[model samples]
Target: MEGMDKEPWFFKDLSRLDAIRMLLAPGNTKGSFLIRESESNKGSYTLSVRDLDNNAGDTVKHYKIRNMDKGGFYITARIAFNSLSELVKHYSREADGLCTTLIKPCQTRIPQKPWWQDEWEIPRESLKLERRLGGGAVWRGIYNNHTKVAIKNLKVGTMSTSAFLAEANLMKNLQHPRLVRLYAVVTQEPIYIVTEFMANGSLVDFLKTNERRQHDHKHPHRHGISGKAQTLWLREWRLLKRGITSTGTCGRPTSWCLRTSSARSPTSASLASSRTTSTRREKVLNSPIKWTAPEAINYGTFSIKSDVWSFGILLTETVTYGRIPYPGMTNPEVIQNLERGYRMPRPDDCPEELYSIMNLCWQEAPEKRPTFEYLRSVLEDFFTAQKQQYQTQPC
Candidate 1:
């Protein structure tokens, strides 16, 4: 019974089901174990170990430690230990009649940081909205009257301020280099989000503009970006898309493209612009049927896997230069077609490799979908293999 009072691994009140969940976590191994007070029997304990073989009675085997009327503990009839600590120590050394010997203590979870680390609030006076960027709530504004920025205004219901800020804090932490950097938030009557300005606008708009230029014939190649540059731009977005999907989040349509020195690429303040009480958020969450996964539309369930289905839609958008998905199909027909396994054909200029990735994303079963991390690595290798083609027209 050494240092029984100081073992943080001893979780006195954790339930049986929660112990199973922790032990079966992806990070856990076969022998990971914990001792918990038995729910049905007061003053007794249960030893839970993860043993994943089907031969074992259960994936997580639980053995009851019967507390003798005298001050001692025992699991098997032949073995008796004077203390709970001694019983645990003895069992760690050998499985004896139990399922498996304990290898490590159940991992103690680190408490999530409960508050925002840095201040995010800004005074309204610091941002100057110069002009409307589109016909929307966003405006081309100057932060501190000097730094050009895009400002988005969101109306908050009086009751939802805390929820809005909590979501904002999460967005601040997950800001990837590929995303539009969120500058400051104004917590006034109409909340304002200030983000770094992108002169060209969303990837959808930028790509459409170029697509039109190519179709015009007179200005067939006047988009000012080389073919190699466009390829690199899309490559960067594949990286960014992975980061976005890792968060398991979806947001309002953003001015996703940043006009890079070489070409137009996607970057977003979409995370910052998800204002919970606002009407815009309502529209975004109720995504058009074409953009939503079948599971999402049918069962109203969303997970990272569902987002993968949407990423397939985004892939089509990228390949076709932002053409509306399932063109000419009504929402009802779109859902019907999706249920019948109707996947979009590869766009005219999309490479076979890219189309294959889209197919992976559109897997009918959620568990069948590949993760964003897998997608990112695949794309990196794909681009590397094609590296020589872009070398001549270096951007």
Candidate 2:
């Protein structure tokens, strides 16, 4: 067989001046070049090109050019651009021209609402302590005539009020079905945050209830399990597992529980005071220390990846129907076991694919752990295929 003619190769590694020089070179107009501002770095741009005789289609070469005097260069990939000017225009809305290091402010900015105010407050008399959630206590209250919310009260002297406020600022921006909704913050001394109440309690308890219902021989309710409810269960699992990274805060709830209506949101209120040890707080709260990720336990460093590691532990707990992670193991024992590459055994009857995901999340190196978005995509596809297979089966 005759070999296919090789396509023209653009310079994959080029300085800002060199790339511009290439574009200005003779006969370079045959193909399109895409240029966009690099997302991770301001004043840096990514240039992607598709030659006239393209073999890879949208799979074009990418080069990062730092235009500033102190800027550097790199190579990356994405989609090809139609024209250099077009790419410049796209990025120009929020940045300077391709050759400059400055970025322009976006024309529109999201207005930050004042979360703490006396008018939006929950009266002390109306607040009733309900249950322990994270590092705080949730109190049931009527914020207004038709608004019933759970108030999360922070312990005095645990965290600075500024830290709490900063957390509230972040929390107020977050809105997702998998996350509990924040109504308002009572900024008064002994700060309290109001959020939507979930009646079904924690996710572990909810899953346990679901597991019992599945095994109930005397009262079969499989037919009563509406598609919506099943989807909701999957959603709850998705949110609890994947929603942390999306929030830009690696804040995972002390428990991966979901209420009937909402998943508990993580805030500074849920974070143990900087002065205290999480293990001590865990003991005080009577929450399991085994769920703490190895990195967190060993180095006291927490990140989004650390939270994902905790999710792996939570996955084991959920699949096992409230069974403890690292059962019969002390915190120190669990830490030692994990450092030596020991992971929890697969839950009985758990899907191999699901277990594989849990393993990915448990990678020893934080960077090696799979992202929440990737895991969610995998699970979504797997469940979709299962649903399709069932639908195609003969009645």
Highest lDDT: give the candidate number.
1
Please, what is the TM-score per model? 0.52, 0.52
Number of clashes in model 2?
Answer: 3
Runs of candidate 2 with Cα error greater than 4 angstroms are: 1-136, 210-212, 215-288, 392-395
User: Each model's RMSD to truth, in Å?
Assistant: 17.2, 16.7
Candidate no. 1 TM-score = 0.52
lDDT, candidate 2, 74-169, per-residue tens: 232232334334344454353232332213211112324454442334455545555565544566766545555677666666556776665565
Residue 82 accuracy (lDDT) in model 2: 43
lDDT of 2 at 165: 66
Instruction: Give the clashing pairs for model 2.
Output: 34-81, 203-257, 203-258
- Total clashing pairs in model 1: 3
Q: What does candidate 1's lDDT look like per residue over 1-395, in tens digits?
A: 34654664476677876676556533356788888888898677888888856322125778898877777888876979888778778878998888788888876444333454235566788888899975656699987767778776764432256654554544444332234556667766677766656655665565567544454334222221222222343454442232222112211132132221101111123323444435433433444557677765665556678767766776676556568888898777787788798988888866787778889989999999987667666766666655544454545
Q: Give the clashing pairs for model 1.
A: 202-255, 202-256, 203-257
